[model samples]
Target chain A: MTEKDLIDACKRKNRQAQRLLYDRFSPVMMGVCRRYIKDPMEAEDVLVEGFFKVLTKIGMYNGDGSFEGWIRRIIINEALMHLRKNNQFKYAEEINPNLDYTEEPTVLDEIAAEEILNLLDEMPPGYRAVFNLYVVEGYKHREIADELGISINTSKSQLILAKQRMEELVKKRLGRHEI
Target chain B: MKTEKNISTLFQKGAERISVQPSGQAWQRLESRLEKEERRGRVVVMRWVASAAAMLVLVAAIWLWSASMQQHNFAILDAAPPQNLEDLENVDGCEPYCLVLKARAELPAYYANPVEKRN
Candidate 1:
């Protein structure tokens, strides 16, 4: 069935249609959730909640944008809410201005998705959240500030700190020849 | 050393390409929650319908009662009193005979017979 047809059936609360939609989108959405949530189980929880919302609130989709993009936004918001509930954004105001940028430039292309996620896991929650919001999610510093309840400068600092920490992680990984 | 932007871009691209299937039981968990939510939604709708039905019943009952009361009042007004009773209503300190006359004027003849105590 076409996406429109599937969406229509799901809106009608058709179980078959709901299953089809979940089967189609859950993997990618789980990946999206995982970027923000370190725990696989928590990421799965967010994914499930996100899909539930996507199905239940499908009527609000006005066809103004890509359906996948709409789903992505919902998943991202769910992940953010999970983070907020866990107080991951609490330290967003602790700005460290003296971030080190001296690490030798490692080839980013050489790292796998798992390694990137591992690097993210090593960073503080606030730094990781800011980095994901600003970089992966493409939110501007102002938007990130609004989302994390921090100032724009804090968002910027957090992103810088996240990157510095990622570089250190990558350098250590390179030393171990894991890449 | 890779610049922050490069790393960010790399991470974004890599994350986009990666895919991991959910655990086998994940779908079951989600389906169960959806069913629970659906049940809750149905309960809300049922409650609303029941409330509306009760309100409609109350309004109908009130309407029927008021209509019956109006019909009874109209029947009383339509019943013509004896012509002399209009004048009797103005009588002051109604004497027993006047009261008997007023009863005779307001009630039908068959009912009024009991009011006549004087010869």
Candidate 2:
């Protein structure tokens, strides 16, 4: 069936259509959830919750843009809400302006995706969130600040600190691998 | 600096390929929540309908009661004695004395037919 047909059936509250929608979008939406939430179980919870929201609010979709984009926005917002509920932004702090990493930077292609997630796991919750929002989600500092309820300066600082910490983790991993 | 951009690229690329399958129980939980919300919404609609029905009944009862009260008032008016005694002034063979006796109720039995005395 066409996506429009599936969406219409969903609006009519058909269970089969709902299941089809979930099966179609859950994988990509799950990946989106995992980028923000750390625990697999919690990430799954977020994914389910996010998908539930998408189904419930499907009537609001007016074909203004891609359906996937609309669903992605809902899932990302749900992840951010989960983080906010956990007080992740309370620990966000301003980075020192003079801080600099002059050492030879590690190349990212050398690290596997699993290694990247493991490195991300070692960082603080606030820094990780800011990094995910700024770098991965492409949110401006103002938007990040508004979403996380932090100052623009704090958002900038969190990104800097997150990147610096990731670089440190990457260097250590590279050293151990070399040894 | 180049590494910073590359780090972003690495995550973006990984995000594109990473897909962890959710547990089986996830759909069950979501379905249960959706059902609960649907039931709640139905309950709210039912409550509103019931309230409106009750209000309509109350208004109808009040209207019926007021209409019956007005009908009762009309019945009382229909049964009441006439207020205008001047209407009896034009009666045949009823003199001023007869009218006075009838009005006072003090006339003797022999004078009960005042019109006969006038004859």
Candidate 3:
């Protein structure tokens, strides 16, 4: 079925259509969840909850935007909610003064996609959330601040720290791989 | 040396390529939750229907009783003086003295011989 047809069927609560939608989106949504939640099981839980919402709230979709984008927003919000529920944002707001800001930027061209995800997984939850929102998800600092309930400056600073931390992690992984 | 733009582009590209297959059980859990929600929704609707039905029955019973009371009041008002205890039983709001008067009028011999009857 066409995407439109699939959505209409889902809106009608068609079980087959719902399952198809889940099968199609769960992997990508799981990837999105993992960027914010490091634990595979927790990420899976968020993925399931997110899909449940998508299916149940399908009627609210007014066809104003791409369905996939709408679903992505829901999944991202769910991940943020999970983090907030766990009090992960407390560490995200703390400014680490001792971070090496002057470290040379390492070439990330040679890194595999899996390695990049692993690097993201290793960062602090707060930094990872900010980084995922700002860089990967293309969210503005203001939007990230609102979603994370932090100041704009905090979002900006966390992005910077997250990048620095990513560089360090990439360098360490590269060094280990080269040896 | 990578600029901020280059770093973001790299990570964004990686994120685009990243897709992990969720465990098979994830769909099962979601399906069960959806079913439960559906069942709950049905239950809520049924509860509302039952409550409405009960309210309707109570209203109908009240209306019928009031209608019968009105009819009985009209009969009592139009009828002649009470000829028997059964007739007096339908006389609503009668004072005790009024009931005594009704009893004496309806059954004179019974009241007249009350003292001898007591003996």
Q: lDDT tens digits, residues A34-143, model 1?
A: 77888999999999889989988998987888999999989988998899998777664556555554444555445677777777778877778887877777899899
Clashing pairs in 1: A104-B1, A105-B1, A105-B2, A106-B2
Model 1 lDDT tens row, B27-110:
888899999999999999999999999999999999999999999989966977434645556555546647777666667876
Ordering by DockQ = 3, 1, 2
**Predicted complex 3: CAPRI docking category:** acceptable
Off by over 4 Å in 3: A90-111, A175-179, B1-5, B73-119
What shift in Å separates residue A84 of candidate 1 from its native position after superposition? 2.2
Q: Candidate 2, which segments miss by more than 4 Å at Cα?
A: A90-93, A96-113, A174-179, B1-5, B67-119
Task: Give lDDT: candidate 1, residue A119.
Answer: 76
Q: Write model 3 residue lDDT over A1-179, tens digit each, in one string.
A: 99999999999999999999998888888889988899999999999999999999999998998899999999999999999999987544546544555645455455566887798889989989988998888999999989988877788778888888887787677662321
Q: Between candidates 1 and 2, name the one with more favorable TM-score.
A: 1
If the candidates were sorted by their TM-score against the true structure, best first, what order would they fall in? 1, 3, 2
lDDT (0 to 1) per candidate:
0.79, 0.78, 0.84
**lDDT for residue A106 in candidate 3, whole number 0-100:** 54
> TM-score of the candidate numbered 1?
0.78
Model 1 sits at an interface RMSD, in angstroms, of: 4.2
